[model samples]
Target: MSTTALSKPWTITRLGWLFQPISDRGHEEAMVLSVYRDHGVIPKDSRTDNFNRTPENLSNYQLVQPGDLVVNRMKAWQGSLGISEHQGIVSPDYEVLRPTAPEYDRRFLHSLLRSRALIDQYALRSTGIRPSQWRLYWDEMKTIEISLPAAKQQRAIADYLDRETARIDTLIEEQQRLIEMLRERRQAVIDESFSTLGDPSVQLRRYIKFLTSGSRGWGDYYADQGERFLRIGNLPRANLEIRGDIQFVDLPADVTEGSRTMLQEGDLLFSITAYLGSVAVIKGDWVGAYVSQHVALCRLERDRVDPRFIGWFMLTTTGQDQLNEGAAGGTKMQLALDDIRGLRVPTASIEQQRRIAAHLDRQTAKIDALVAETERFIEYARERRVALITAAVTGQIDLREMA
Candidate 1:
């Protein structure tokens, strides 16, 4: 965790790992081998599908030995560091490093390379010729410097982190499992509400006094003026794509004239278009936008159904089925407003809607907490590994005399 500006002569250039031995033309046809960041146990691949190689588009190079720290030179900043415990052919973009001495643990080295500190430094050094084509060169990668403790201290640190992080990872996995269970429970709740055996509920159509059809097509609003014009693709699959990142088009002056379709808190935005059942609840008091041709601005009768509950249901299996079953297009499929308005919905009393929403809110909050913690552990486990490598190479953690 310390840095110094001193120069050292003990540094040796890395002869990146070799990989030609793992490739072969077998079974029926020639197959290309490749390695991905998900290859090892950190993400836990329980597949027998040869984590080594597959038919990939990229050329393969560099045989990575077990325990060799492999990094994608270009995407090193994006946490693409992994410890290769099995030999595999991967994209030539990978730069595999094996420490010259045992002072550094390979896992530690891999983690350090992926640490925020190293990643930020890598980002700072990178140059992007285009918006997407950014490159981080390997030659410059070697010069990254770090201060480290002695060899004994290095091993002690790695061992300490390995034990602590494993426990954290286990907890994270359990929390993640709990989140999935909550999701399943939420789906069950939806299924029960719609079933005839459940408490009395209202038919979906009764709530709407005026269910008008949506504005024509994308062509009708091309001339619209200064307001957020939302399209089907613009709507996110899960959470609202925090607005700053969402692309918006200006509404023509004529369309913005007193549109009741403006988004509001508790308003349920439904896509009755191609992605027929996708739904999202307005998170806060967002009031500027009007729906695109493909989206429906549902003014839900809040007395019968909670918009939040509807949003959740649409994302669940039952709601998806209800949507898919009502779908009515040939090639580029879509569900018209009439098709959706006539669709049956399971409803409950106001008190019940609030209760279901509150229960789901609590469960989702717990799931979010677990996801955040797991992410943090992933970062730490990754960083600790890299610190071990930085320490060993700089002569700060010396293992030259130990075998």
Candidate 2:
């Protein structure tokens, strides 16, 4: 990290990428020239809209030069700003700004565009408009003031940030790959357990006790209301992860009337409808509201079944087959209360079950640890990339001097 100050009185302006006049093309024919999301441009091929233009339309549409500061006027608040280095055409909705002054570093302009001040301006200006469609009018956006850094200093900071952020990105990618591998190994563990059990003498229903779904007249609540809510959307696919589909809700008094519905350690949560059969286990002390209508809370009778074993089984082929078969409904399949009650499972003695679960847990934990370390490295790389850019632009580190 470098402690460098930028030159004073930095000027700011909106770079309208859509400088060229619209061609003789219909809105539908106007191929999506460019798409920006999360501080990066969406690849031309991955574009879901028809805003990006091919070379055919490039001549008629406005152009974006390399290193120009461009922003998706509509989504600037969501960080849809980037340095346009690719030879690509963007939607007419975008405003591209090329630095008018030689003293202004293009890289410095880009960083400043993404700074807190600019983003806040976009947010405040967005008042009452649909957040997704709020556009930054260049006339209004260009007047936004900024503290300027010396041209040389600006270049240095930009260079520093680029190098450091690249390192962080590499680390994150490695961690993601390792996490995938760990999950695969964990899946194998589950598969092996089922295969090794051979023929079970005990009947599935006799040894296992599956909780039936209760009444389904629960009302809804907002996530921002300060309640910890779990929905079926939170459950990950077998051998996958839980990432942000589910929302939190404030706990309502009526839902927690009895202790039976309260979520606890070792309980398996299953989706009943919508995204049918996705599952996750409550591993530790989790304080949250009761399940939504789309989910079923399963509690295993300890005397008959091991909670960990049941969770593992659900991850295997056998469990999935049962889940699919038991699922009802056409478009959105659902597993009925009776179907879950009737599903078969392999049960073992408490000692055997404990041994198997512990073994798998240790192996998975080791893999998770490796992934976490790689992720930390990725964070360091990201910070370094930003710092490098900042250093180059601020003149704390001179790239020209090194050359």
Candidate 3:
């Protein structure tokens, strides 16, 4: 709570005094609603990304009406509660609350209750031995005291936030669209770079020297200061670069796979497991590193076919299509060493291959930089939105006109 009083008068009261919990259950016929930390409450069927499967029987679901506060007990501290605008049914584990008096504005409560400060309060009040088990049930939630201005001033604050956030959201949407466009353009650049060379009929097996997938027994060679151990995550999806966090493992002299899978400079790496076709070329300091079983080590005939040129081609659409078609599939899809060897590539001079690789390297670097920058901008916009809401709800801003 702020020590300084605002220009408008405010009243401090417990949440229980303002809102009452209603336990009306078994609304299986109603539409399902879900509470998201970022999106608040929305129809469950509207999003495809949520991994949690809804139960076939909705017998225990609770009925919810418009303007009622729906709290996902397990995630309330994470700002996953919201004043619902749709009539639906939420899980019985959630708390359904409605204003006891008309003095409260749903819009005002939406912003205030979900603000960072209030979420911190919710976290402090939540009970659990583990974070995953943390829950904010109604008994503890009702005791939290908050200061509220008159209903009119509350409306003014809510209106201000709604207007400001919409503008920020617009900019964020534009930035996201730009990022998608840039990615498509990046892929097009790769496809176009390889398009000039005639049909890829040359069997990749003709130029390859030795091929083997990494062996298991990963935990046996665990160490902090030793050779780099590259996992499936190290393979980049966009280009032929080995990226992401590195894990170093000390290799035992007796370990047979360590010598067998030791990566060499100019060596081409392919994802032989579930990831399928992501490829990277080892360079400089990464030469002595070993790979996990999921990655395939392909020591190419560098004289006949440039390693980087082949690596870049593996990222192109045509390359990805061949790998997907040839990979063995059932529950899990994966590529065999022979499948990689069987891949076809455009037969070209080593000089032309180097030129193609160079062109893609430059083009992709520019696109990746732009995508990173745009993502940062979106992040900043989200931070600003949260800050604005917190300021409004905490009475840090004066809304004397609405008083």
Candidate 4:
């Protein structure tokens, strides 16, 4: 048979028709299900098992049956649509669909709709000012065109994807475990090096010229391109490097007070709230960046203390223990400026500190390289998985030939 024999263009509505919107008006005693963005439908009870509080009235909920297609309308553009495997009632905000013809493979359609290409189609059809608020209504979703294959071909493709993706997922999991081990090893090295210093301890206040947080009300100065604005979210958990999701703001002449929070190369930063004790060092790239109020800037006495060594010390168990003991507040832990000032830090001679920092910098670079390579491999594996699913469901690749 020709490779393209099974390919046929079909609109989404033609493949599986929408289920008549049914409400539990008369049936108030139904199980409530919630549709997760990427994950499939899950009963609300399961999510709130600890609270054990079911809604007093589920009469407004919509009923869903096995094999029905469920889409969280608000998040449909994010690949939130999936075939329901459970018989329950979902929120009225969700859309439900059922296959119109017996020949349609539900699993194949699920894979097709969740593919990256189709998800982008969903984004195109969605309407909203921002991505977070985008909504894919039924009118747009119904008109989406998809390539269909014969029922047997569809089933075969789904089965092939299921088997292949499982193997890829296993490998990804193994790589994730290896990355975790590498992190632990890096941490152990940092802890050992710091513990063996056998040097005098000094209050952090003595070594630092200034310890202060950023001023508020700078939101008005936020700009797409300007000086980088660092926040608690930008701080890495273990590494001394600052990275990811950095925002920027124009350095307006009137906002001169922000200069105090502006970072210098080799300066140390500590997260004061939420993820307390998370530390990072200001690199050359972030030299002029300003930090948020949630972050504490420590301008070190470079002549006496090495910033890198201080940053690494915070990641060690001893340093964390001291920070943890002084940490205040429940649920949302915070480190007060005074508490941070009082915390004792180990101090070796400047030369020894520089040597230790240099050694760690080299060791961590090696570990970071390995972790980055494994992360790239995982990304490729995920991309391959998505491509395989898209090709199979769209009949871009013939399963019979692969078989």
TM-score of each: 0.63, 0.68, 0.93, 0.85
Model 2, CA-based lDDT: 0.61
CA lDDT, every prediction?
A: 0.55, 0.61, 0.87, 0.79
1-403: candidate 2 lDDT, tens digit per residue:
3344433444443333222222232334333446465445444666556453465544444455565556777777776777665645565566666555545666666775665556777777654358866777666665555555556656665665666666667677777787788677767767787787864344345544556443454345555655445666677775333435445556467755434566766766777886655777775424444566677777777765777776667668777777887874466578766676677777677888878767766766676677677667767766665555444443454344422
Q: Name model 3 segments beyond 4 Å from true.
A: 1-5
Error of 1 at 125 (Å): 2.8
lDDT string, candidate 4, 89-169, tens digits: 876678877655646677787788788888898899899999999998877777777776666777887788889888989
Backbone clash tally (model 1): 16
Q: In angstroms, how far off is 79's CA in candidate 1?
A: 2.4
TM-score result, candidate 1: 0.63
lDDT score, candidate 1, position 178: 62
In candidate 4, stretches whose alpha carbon ends up further than 4 angstroms from where it belongs are 1-20, 25-32, 43-59, 198-201, 223-228, 245-256, 330-332, 401-403
Candidate 4, position 16, lDDT: 27
lDDT of 4: 0.79
Q: List the lowest-lDDT window of 10 residues for candidate 3.
A: 1-10
Question: Model 2 Cα displacement at 19 (Å)?
Answer: 8.1
